[model samples]
Target: MSSIDSQTTYLKYREYSDLLKVILYSSQSVLGAVPLIYHLKHNNQNIIFIQTGTMGGNVIHYLISNGPPSKKFIELKRLTGDYTFVDKIGTDGMSLYIPILELEKSNLDFP
Candidate 1:
């Protein structure tokens, strides 16, 4: 590929990475692990901590099930699908205060 083509590809990949980061952060916010202020200013969304799902399913399921007060529990289930692998963040006893540089090298990867 030409240099221009490679540069275009790299830029597109970067955009996708950024989009993924937004999605991850937003989901984390829904779990009340982190605030969404970094992503959105003047945000008025009520935050709710996802309770431990000892029953079954993943963390996403837990959040959807126990979403904010305005949205009914049943409504959440109707709006979301099953997330097979995700679970509650920091449930593994990991420290949230780990430095930003260390986060990139975090061994938080799951199967």
Candidate 2:
């Protein structure tokens, strides 16, 4: 691995459980997704996702991480309802929409 990749993984995912915290709280912000992208860009491991109390009060299962960067995702951006694209947005202000499938799936952790 390159030194940059090593540094990114070391800092972003030092604790496996912290991924949960970051997803649940900060997924919509640069702080959360940047580290997540860094980690995914460098690592092949996937994160387990567990959900309880669904439509029928059942449990659902999925994996919540990716292998590497895809070209489409690299060019993706969040946009407002008015179609204003943004890279970084505030946590509690106007919502920024991300349309990429993987990122939308990652947002399911926000609970």
Candidate 3:
């Protein structure tokens, strides 16, 4: 498994779980969807803005922590024409709007 401490731009999975609890409680809803945009300070250095939403009962987390684009993902993005995955987050990172579960299952990485 990858080391959570090595990640600089995104929160650990457990942290996300905690944040999801807070959002669910504060929003006071358990049926529909709640979208959230959070500005997080990472390691007291970089400021990263993460976008997430709750759908049905699942928390969908966008990942912007893959660092830079790998040649394989770039080619896949080009072939698929899914430029939406290249969204800019904060000042430097690019975002990929994949569901948290799918992200965990796939080995693909993006910028």
Which prediction has the highest lDDT against the true structure? 2
* Tens-digit per-residue lDDT, 1-111, candidate 2: 543333221122333244334333444554445222322211335443333232434332333455422332222223322332244433534443332233323322211
Residue 3 in model 3: shift from native, Å?
38
Residues 75-108, candidate 3: write the lDDT tens digits: 1121222333322222322322322211212221
The local distance difference test score of each candidate is 0.23, 0.33, 0.31
Question: What TM-score quantifies how close candidate 3 is to the native fold?
Answer: 0.22
Model 1 Cα lDDT, one tens digit per residue, 1-111? 543333221111122223233334444565644311111111232222221222332231111112233212211111232122222223332222111110122111111
TM-score of 1: 0.17
How far does residue 6 in candidate 2 sit from its true spot (Å)? Answer: 1.7
Off by over 4 Å in 3: 1-14, 29-35, 40-111
Identify the leading candidate in terms of TM-score: 3
If both were scored by TM-score, which would come out higher, candidate 1 or candidate 2?
2
RMSD of 3: 14.4
In angstroms, give how far residue 99 of model 1 lies from its true place: 32
lDDT of 1 at 16: 20
